[model samples]
Target: MLRGVKREVCLSNLTLQHPRPYLFVTAQCDHRIFYGCWRVFWATYHVIWVLLSWVLEPWVLYSSSERVKWFIYLTNWTYLLLAVQAVTEAVNFFCVHSLREDIVADQQAVPMPWYLKLQWLLYNIVTTGSFMVTAWYWAVLYKSDTEIGAVRVSFHAVNSVYVLLNLFVTATPTRLLHFIYPVLFGVAYTLFSALYQLGGGTNIRGEPYIYRVTDWSRPWKTLLMSSLSNFLAIPFMHLLVFLLRLMVGRLWECWRGSGGSEEGETRRGRGRGVTCVDLGQRMTESSSIQAELLVSCE
Candidate 1:
């Protein structure tokens, strides 16, 4: 059936292949001169800001009695993932740039690198996880803690902004099936919370729950919330990001302008989905574009 074939094709997109190296560094349109630099700058900035947050976290929780258990919370865990994502992205750009010549030399289609795959997985987790944490904290647990400090705001609020900005700008491909990563992340955290409860752990407030929604006292309620969060909320967030990416892609295409050349058509086809164009060719083209831009700027 056509439906079954289409389903298979859709699932194929989830595989960790076809991610052109240029996608990591360049924007979707890839026309702008400063786009790659701007992306690297954000990655570097995220690393610096996250490091600063780590330093300030201890001070922020100095007054709390169970401050040492900060890592037990979902918010902190998500923030830590965000930190990893930021570092991975920065390193990805470095590798891509450093090995540009090598990448361009090999005419074969190179599979997406392992580190790039890790970065992409982390991207899925933090994008949805950060937003989930922010939404849950603000909606359900806003007044539970009186700690309205910069650390709190940064973790619960600005984290979403950081990921959303990346989502809006990056050319990184998103697959419908990739929603499973963040869902698995949520499930893993949920299991950890349950185990923490079984171990007679207490929250910062000395309550036997990491989160009010995830409290084990009411097992059924916790199960419902956890299921909804992991299964429903994460998928919904992923869909929202996917839609946003599509819209951003359209805008980028519009800005890029149309061309009648075969190369232009190939470049434009990337917006539809991850195409299996020759990696070496793509990298060679990307390098040439960068060189041209540099010469123009000078």
Candidate 2:
């Protein structure tokens, strides 16, 4: 009877130690940096991006054309860098999975859990989608004026699609999406901000939260804080952009009026004397013809 009990105990221990087939897949699927420090870092990155895109670009737009060109160049490089980072992370995920067998016994490897699989899928979608949108936006900046509008539309559409998809994919009755929504926004804002700042592109007038370097404490901290700040700041940023655009419009109008007044005064002074009048009349006619010619060319 004692020997029989010893054998039963051994069998029970073996059964308890046996690994499930789905465990490996499930672990892989669920392995995401969603909680704690990861989430904090993610949030910070986005907040910076948003601030750059919405604020810095517009401010820069008021600067010289040479500066704008330099800005655009910076943005393109930044987007490419970010895309590389995302791809690297994805590769790391695969690398870990490949070595799973060595880490765990065959019996313990379980199938992938549904939620973990979903998370992985969403990660791929968001990263790829963001890369594509940012790349296109940069490309458009270099292209002719005619293509810029279309490219802008495409960027917005892609962005909307990804954001909505994220919402749908993560949605749960428990309101898990709410907790994660802030995180996602932070991520998007960071990406968007980085692209905007590096590209030298300004935010759309109605959009807000232009990224600023001063807002960040350090490189990594900036990335994380910017992302996290999106939850509280994005709406305010939007309002700020709107008001800023209005102010910009007023300033532009004033500048245009001043320029027009100066030109009119110069033309009138040139119109005063007989020979000068003839020259002025001829010049006026030439200017009219030039304007017509330009209009036709357009």
Task: Compare the candidates by lDDT and give the number of the best one.
Answer: 1
**What is the number of backbone collisions in each predicted candidate, taken in the order shown?**
0, 47
User: Taking the tens digit of each residue's C-alpha lDDT, what string does model 1 give over 1-298?
Assistant: 1221133235555665543545655554554346646656766666676667657756365655465677898888898888878777776766676776443333235556788788888988898889898999898889865778777888898888877877766777665577889999999999999999999998877888888778899999899988988899899988777666645544444344333122434442432222233212222112221111111111
Best by TM-score: 1
Which whole-number lDDT from 0 to 100 does residue 146 have in model 2?
A: 43
Compose the digit string of candidate 2's lDDT tens values, residues 1-298. 1221122223222211212322212221122343223333433443345344434444466546434433333243333333343343344344445665532233323553443344443443344345434543454434455444432343334443433332222211111112233245346647756665555554433222243441232558666655434554433332332233223323322343344223332311211222312322322211211111111111
User: Candidate 1 lDDT (Cα, whole model)?
Assistant: 0.66
lDDT of model 2 at residue 172? 12
TM-score of 2: 0.25
TM-scores of the models, in the order given: 0.76, 0.25
Model 1 alpha-carbon miss at residue 140, Å: 1.4
Segments of candidate 2 deviating more than 4 angstroms: 1-86, 102-154, 160-298
Q: How many residue pairs clash in model 2?
A: 47
